[model samples]
Target: MFALKMNVLMIITIIMIMSFGIFGETISKTNSETKLIADLLAGYHPKVAPTDNGPVQVKMGFDMSYFDFIDEPKELAIAHGFVYRGWNDHRLQWNEADYNGTRRVNLDRNTVWVPHIQAANSAKVTELLESQVLVFSTGRVRFYQSLQIEFLCDMDLTYFPYDKQSCNIEFGSSLYTTEHINLTASPNRGTNGSRVNSAKDFQITTLDVQRSEKSFRFIAPYSFVDVTYTIGLKRVSSVYRAKLVVPSVLTSFLILATFLLPTASKEKITFCSNMFLCLLLLIAFLHTTVTSTVETVLGQLLAFSLFVDFFATIMAVVSYNIKNRGTSILTRKDYGIMLQDTTMDGDSGMRAEKTLSTKFAWLRYIDVISFIGFSIVFVIGLAAILNQRE
Candidate 1:
């Protein structure tokens, strides 16, 4: 009986051991082989850092897939791109094939020591998604990082709707001195890639990347390396040309045509005054909405038209006074001659008619002269605007 009990006990112990072994190998992850990876990356920081002359070289480049103007008030531009920072980190390396056949892994950004670069213009980063770390057999690792940037850029909008602008995306290190981290941009510093060609209001005219160095303080050697991306933008003028320019031209034409109205009609003065007021309102609206108080060719022309209309108003008044005075003189002289039995009839007729034609003769041709003068100015203004800086 003792021998039989020993055999039973040994069998039971063996079964328990086998069951635990199978479960431990495949089911229960309490003791995983990945623990080796965890321990290796548990506390790893990049070894490469700034040298004496410069910070450790952190080669920076971007693939700009999306870009748009988000705010007009603050002059803010938003760019969606992949900014990859490359460096040598022997610390984050392992034989992935030997370790569960893993070639890469997704890691937390905080776990890795990344460059702390900022936009020189105080732009902010909006989104920072998941980071990826890839390991090769040679202990080389590459990190893929993404960022969504919203920054204030210097925008030159001189021509406005018919204008082209050059804006910049400048970057530099804020926290680290030049000794700790040297940030450099790639080729054209960066590219808008293929997607920016379809920008709505602005077209990419030039993508220029430039590198410049500056020392912030007045005291010592506190210098920084910066990358500037000058994006040349040409306004798609078809919309403004159709919406504002065409209508303004037509309105100006109407204003010029006002001279055809008979000077005797009371509507001539009122009409010119009303047109001038409307033109002023248009100028004010453009100033408020388009490009501040700066005047455009159209604005200049509008101002000139106002002056022309004011002169027309004066001429209208003068002509009316002349006609009325001529009529009064003729009536008085004719009545007096009738009272004197018509001895001065010939002289009276001659004096009344001759004085009116000779004195006010210029008034008869005033409309033609005004039209010619205005036409010359209008043509000159049109030519100048058409040849406005590109």
Candidate 2:
């Protein structure tokens, strides 16, 4: 039993020794490779372009992770993503076999020549990754920078909640013109495994990338390459319809109901006044919610409501005046009955009664005409609003 225990201990010690030896060798090899990479970059100038003759072609693209938020009033959209850039640096190339088959090395971004690319329409940009890059032995350099970018979006809110908007993000070299650098779109540029199609009140419908060239005059005309990413967004309007449209429509019906009330009753004017206040409140709510300076369907609806309110209130006053005039002439004490005695006073009373009846007929005519006019206008306006959805 003592000899068996001795053998077991010997085996364990041998295994541990072998493991340490392997680990030491790995560490030594890694250090040697790192030294070799350092030696290769000893005389390199990071500010100089890695080319001898023509412009260096940089493959650049964006991989969108998700949408953060969209501020409609501010016309800003925030997105989280990675900016990918690749180029060849011939000075950094080395034989991998001499360094124990080391194919890739990581270097600090500050120690290399990087293109000065920026978003032209961005309000602000925040970096969210470590400042490092991957360098391959074949002279290929790759850089990935995670960024949270806020892009300026010029939105058209004509249709408001049902509106479709297109926002553009422009990327270009800020310092170097086409003479020193050429920008090319990477083939794999676009959304990267992101399932987020909706953000807050908008849904992404389309993403398009395009390349173009623009001329800028510094001392002379210098052309620069620009890559633009267009994002198509459609507003999700279920909430707006419930909060704005449905309520406005109900209030419109209430405005029409003012005309349906008895002309003699004082409630007609009171109803009109209440509806005017309600319409004012709705307008105020709309202004607070959607701070757009453009003309919109909801704005048109509110304006129409005001016009209907004014017309209804005027008609209500006219109706009250007519009722008062009829009452003064035909006393309720006599139950609006004319005397049959053939006298001058009786003739005058008869004529007054006829005039009162004519006035009542005109009041009815005004109510019918105003109601029909407003109803037709409301239907046309609703149709117009619906047609604006695109």
Candidate 3:
């Protein structure tokens, strides 16, 4: 009886031991998973907030072990992309900060930044590896890290459809036309090591675009705001082209008008001079509008217009001289010698009937030809100027 009782006691003890062991293992696994998730959440803390001037502020954060992919020592890697001082360029707005301390930025303006990370229980990331993934990784040394990024910018709001709406763009007239633009970005931190220190996933979030007109400014039906975000690629900001079509057309016309004026008296000279002066003034206006603005391939085209105008002014002066002076002056030059002799001798009629005609028969023909040639040149120059693409 005693032996049987002991055997029962032993069986109960073994079952209890087995149950305790299973329970302990389950709790350990649960704790490990929770720790893993907590560590990752601690790393990402990107936020977007409002600034005084109505633009949003974006801020981002990242940890030190993140740089191991590029062979950086933990100390150096943690300091990889911090904005310790002022912004490197105009595109980035940085706050004046204590350089020796941790790097931080005010996202109240457009900028990109990175901050130092702490080294504690850092582990290598091994399982997650994909060539297309934003994170860069090397198998040798792995680390668990986090990254945060934000954007502070005004939404490109289109109360008027940017692609379809017709807006009157005035150079003294209103025409229905569509307007569009391209936006781009530049790195503001660790640019020298940009290839290695860039954010794994820099993203824009919390965009707000709104439009309002006077009568019911704040009402929802009358006005609305839209918001959306996605991964974005950064591009260099540059002037794609320079367009000055109206000014160019006006300049060309001024050149042509010089031909229409009479050069028989000082009035014509004064008029041509005034027109020339106005053209010069217009060129100056164009120069002022475009100077320091940017020089593009299109800018070179505008320059060509200026050159054509300069040549036109010279031609105008030359034409004025030809018209005011009689055939006597022009005939002395080698170019006009034959032309004038032909026209003038014909006017004299001195050799009429002697040669079955006059020596000036060709001269009369020359006069007709000169007028026609001048008119043709003027028309062609005007057409070229007016036809330029805006």
Task: Give the winner by lDDT.
Answer: 2
Model 3, 1-390: lDDT tens per residue? Answer: 999999999999999999998887667655544443343235333232112333222222222122321221121111222211111212222222222121222231212222111212123223232211111111011122233222222221111001011111001001111111111111232222224433332211111122112223344233211112211222111121123445544554454454444433455456556655655565565445333212322233334445544544555465545543533443334332344355556534343323322333443344345445645754664454334221
Q: How accurate locally, in lDDT, is each candidate? A: 0.66, 0.80, 0.32
Point out the worst 10-residue segment of candidate 1 by lDDT: 332-341
lDDT per residue for candidate 1 within 176-258, as digits (tens), equals 66667666765653664345533687777776667777776652485777877777777778767776666666667667676
TM-score of each: 0.74, 0.88, 0.26
What are the clashing pairs of model 3? 123-143, 124-142, 124-143, 125-143, 342-363, 343-363, 346-360
TM-score of 3: 0.26
The collision pairs in model 2 are none
Weakest 10 consecutive residues of candidate 2 by summed lDDT: 335-344
Which whole-number lDDT from 0 to 100 does residue 105 have in model 3? Answer: 21
Better of 2 and 3 by lDDT: 2
Ranking by TM-score: 2, 1, 3
Q: Give lDDT: candidate 3, residue 342.
A: 52
Task: List all candidate RMSDs to the true structure.
Answer: 7.7, 3.9, 21.8
The runs of at least 3 residues in candidate 1 whose Cα sits more than 4 Å from the true structure, single-residue gaps closed, are: 1-37, 41-54, 94-102, 122-124, 128-146, 197-199, 217-222, 321-331, 334-355, 364-367, 388-390
lDDT of 2: 0.80
